[model samples]
Target: MRTRQSVCARKARYASAAVALDAAKVAGLALRPYRCDRCWQFHLTSRTKGKWMPITSLYS
Candidate 1:
């Protein structure tokens, strides 16, 4: 598994992009998959609906 500076980063490998989309729908989160340049794997990220915020900010 790899880590990203972005707080909302979540990585998961599915057989296909459609499968990933289905999983995201089941979780009730709006997500889309893109090919990672470094790892060359698919990663799902939340659709940007508002201003970008770091996950750490929620704790502080």
Candidate 2:
């Protein structure tokens, strides 16, 4: 039988939320940081729902 890895397992793990958010910023304005329940670590999500505001708004 074959095993499947979870989304959390495949994604990169960040030590802190700040680090994750920073990475997201560098990656692009469309990305955001989110806490993974299983890993207890921060990861970036590309979902553009909710408060997915662009960083450019803060500057302008």
* Candidate number of the best TM-score: 2
Clashing pairs in 2: none
For each predicted model, how many residue pairs clash, with residues at least 3 apart or on different chains?
A: 0, 0
Error of 2 at 50 (Å): 4.4
Mark the regions of model 1 whose C-alpha exceeds 4 Å error after superposition.
Answer: 1-10, 47-60
lDDT of 1 by residue, 1-60 (tens): 344535324556665777777887888765766556555566677755664656874565
21, model 2: CA deviation in Å? 1.1
Model 1 Cα shift for residue 28 (angstroms): 0.6
Q: Compose the digit string of candidate 2's lDDT tens values, residues 1-60.
A: 221248878888899989998887888765677777777788888776566586885575
Give lDDT: candidate 2, residue 48.
Answer: 61
